[model samples]
Target: MVAVRTARTLGLALALCFFSGAFAGVGTAQEKKAEKAKSKLKISVPQDDAELQIEGKATKPTGTVREFETPDLEVNKAYEYTFSVTWRPNNYTTLTRTKSVEFKGGTADINVDLTKADPKAPDKAVIRWVPTPDDVVEEMLKLGSVKEGDVVYEPGPGDARMLIAAVKKGAKKGVGIEIDAKKAAEATENVKKAKLDEKIKIIEGDALKQGDYSEATVVLLYMGNEFNALLRPILEKQLKPGTRIVSHRFTMGDWAPDKTVPVKGADGDEYMLHLWTVKEKK
Candidate 1:
């Protein structure tokens, strides 16, 4: 009877061991399946020194490529992946490029070439040329309080109409920085036609690199939000106290406007104007 009981007990222990091993194997398989469901992104940069950010989170690069792993995603659903790279090439200005791509659940690759992504390229205007309506321009100048002895400056000036009007309104000088050569010539010709060439000057260059707006008593902008953001640092650093910045239909990011006004353009469209005044640096 004792021998028979020992055999039964040993048999029961072996059965329990087998089931435990099987459950452990199942758990391992589930873990592998969970890992397979994750999404992976591979980014390739032109240089190793470039700063990379994925979804606003800073990522460290391994050589020229960085492999980023994300949580599990729905197989058929598309997701937007955004990344930005900041790098300064030898003898060139520092440039930051942001790109977004729609990606499905899988391994994805992105290549960033800084040389081709330069925003200051002569032919590559960041913002399209949209002329502010005559009535809107008048309102913008008035909102900026441009008057005699004021040096009015416009960046990405579509035409010199705003500057001509500013000078005619008793501004001492008007300066326009235009990126496109053709537009610059057209604006210069327009100034000559208005007989204000002596008071107004149109510069053919990239507005982002101009760096000098210290003389501007009133700055006028009709650029988009992105362009305004890129110019904000330069404006704050160079513009003097009491200088007024008037933007038509766009505001600098996070920098609240001192005053905002709404005007009806002659085209029967309502336009918004934002004004920011530079305060004395404490």
Candidate 2:
């Protein structure tokens, strides 16, 4: 009887071990499956010396990484990351700006090429404040064929009227940079009064020195001929292909416009608008 009982007890212990091992294997497979469901983030930069920082109130980035993984992030959830990149483009300019990027799906790719990023040259802020009238704004948009979801940027946005108008005309977003503090403040107030604070953003900074409008799908300029000429090279290098730029009463030096038209303003003054679409560089 004792031997029979011993054999039965040994069989029960062996069965328990086998079942526990099978369950453990399933748990390991489940962990591996969970690992595969996490998302990934990748950032590409021109130089190894370049630095990229994702700026948020509680957010911190490790460094300029070629590959990053978001194992904790929920699947299919989109997250917006604003980055400040400081890099010397071929030892050119130490460019820095707060720019946004949307990360979704299983992977996110961010490419940083400052070949024409921000013209962060330590030059004096050349302020030639030329305000664009509402009629001129309308004409400029008409000339550029501004459409919905277009990003409009005005470098020397005097009072941000151009940006506000662009937003009103159905552009997705508008950004205005003004060198003068008073004008920037006024632009802010004007945007607030128009109830366009959500759609238009005004930056109190130098247009000549600050050059991160690379996101602009349509650039509206009211600068002088000389300023526009000086800014031509930077715009050419930075702006993406098929991007449209329109200037009031000025021209981009050697790079000729796709079309130039004369529009009479509500004030009865004729304005010369020049539109240029960025093309492949030779």
Which candidate wins on TM-score? 1
List the candidates' TM-scores in order. Answer: 0.60, 0.55
Superposition error at 76 for model 1 (Å): 41
Tell me how far the alpha carbon of residue 170 in candidate 2 is from the true structure, in angstroms, after superposition.
Answer: 0.8
Off by over 4 Å in 1: 1-41, 44-125
Candidate 2 residue 141 C-alpha distance from true site, Å = 0.5
Predicted candidate 2 versus true structure: per-residue lDDT over 182-243, tens digit per residue: 98899999999999998898898877657686898999987766567567767877898988
Per-candidate Cα lDDT values, in order, are 0.72, 0.65
Error of 1 at 125 (Å): 6.0
Candidate 1: C-alpha lDDT: 0.72
lDDT of 2: 0.65
